[model samples]
Target: MKDVYLFSGFLGSGKTSMLTDVIRQLKEKNLKPAVMMNELGKLPFDSQVVEKDIPLKEMLEGCICCSGAEKTEAQIQSLLLDSNFDVLIIETTGAAHPVEALDAVYSPLFADQLNVKGIVTVVDTKLWLHRQTLTPQVRSLFMEQIRHAHLLLANKMDLLTEAEQGQAVYELQGLNPHAFILQTTNGRVPLNLLEDLKATAQVAKKEIIKAPLSAMQLGSCLVEFTGKEFTQEQFEEWVRTLPDTVYRMKGYVPIEGIKNPMLFQYAYGMVQWLPEYLKMPAKLVMIGENIDTVPVIGFN
Candidate 1:
């Protein structure tokens, strides 16, 4: 059986950057590994960065829950059959619920083939306080990601002061007393934190939090596209048209003339782009609650 590590965090928490570094460290230790990325958007930026050296696969279009439990199990089985990797690393989307992601991995189909070694939850020190002020749905997502993690990586520590860092750690501890909390910069926790971890003797059951009626009233629609090329300007215009209700959008796109694919990330109304070479075919995934895909694709 292969060891599986789940890496999860909220938007801009540096999960990818940290995972990339971890892969490099694993290589130095002579460990063969494979990565699975659950990207919210069409582009696979995280996958591209690691694919150059490690075998990488991606699950796009929605969160692990959106794919339903069975499909995720099949995907894991297929990846194991296709590769000789000793470890499997899954990077969940920023808005993902880690508990749900974990539950999916424990599905009967993958239980015998994959062993979950640990969960490393990356926390953005700078955003932790502010996130509490957001809607309950958003807050729940962030908390659930940290709650059951075996290693709570309080990342982006450089952004916080000594007092702020201490307070953040304190709060995280309150949320998950069993997790080993560590301060890190850019998601750089030591590799030993995961090196020898074995899945809990029995998979720990996860607590399910039902969305309140008001929260359930808000819904999201996800659309995915796979193609060879996209115009940079058009992509920007298309994303700009997203409605306010569209809380997050992420993915990668290979620009027509640019040498590297562009990573697109949007949260609330903030947007960021990172340009890098494409290690796989071009794809885009968009997530918008109560929004239509017509304008999103039309812009491209």
Candidate 2:
């Protein structure tokens, strides 16, 4: 069976950066790979970073594990019929839970045409270590993303010490004992890790790993923002004022007089800013404990 690889990771887990490296490896080997990316927000930024040569398709504004699942199934079918690519690489939204996302591909329609290559979930080791203090629902959602992975890419290894890295590996191993764990820096991993041959054994054993229904139903709200162009100063102030319960905030915003979209991210009490060029809408999505306390700001 031809293999279809699903890449699952949490927000800011470096999926795009890692995929860039993987694409280069595939090219070097003359491996024909097609891509299907799921972006949770309407404004898709990572697609631009991907190399233009590869055949790429996208599902936006929804997680492929949920609302986008049917669309994903149809797209994959379309890609298969339309192209002769050797392997299909699907990079799912950080919010995508493997348990749910797998449902999209396990249909009888593609069973013969496609083989489950294995779900490779990426973990930001730095954040993994400190995320225990988050609310139970958030914690469960994070754990749910990794529960059925055939491989776990322990990313951001450079941020940890030797002992901490070991601990991260151990933690991931414990999270999904069936998974093969590998340490990765900046999302780069050995090419063999992405190969169909390497994952066959694990994929054969993968069945659904379900989380509690209650926890599965609860998660951070997907907030939509519009009608405001803020000054740089105002934007900074607003992010700083977000609720303590908010652990992650990311997306792009338009600032007055700035030619490029202002990339924004907030995590672990710190915020980062970057000027990114994308004509997409300015939308901010935050995943955390309590989103109700998040406030909207107007610079006018």
Backbone clash tally for model 1?
7
For candidate 2, lDDT tens digit of each residue in 1-300?
566787888889988888888888887888888898888778768888777777888888877766676688688888888877877888888777775676555433344466556677888889899988768887787887776566778999999999999998988887777667888888887888667333321111112111121212212333333455778787777767776756555666777888756777666588888887765446554544323334543422
Local error of candidate 2 at residue 49 (angstroms)? 1.9
- Go through the candidates in order and give each one's C-alpha lDDT: 0.67, 0.68
TM for every model, in the order presented, reads 0.65, 0.64
Off by over 4 Å in 2: 196-300
The residue-by-residue lDDT of candidate 1 on 1-300, one tens digit each, is 677888888888899988888888888889898888888888876677875667777777777755654566677878877777888888888877765676556533234455566678899978896786878998888887787576788988888889998999999998877677889997887788776554332221221111121211122222333344668677667767766755555555677877756766566677788875655323333333223322543322
Off by over 4 Å in 1: 202-300
Best by lDDT: 2
Q: What TM-score does prediction 1 earn?
A: 0.65
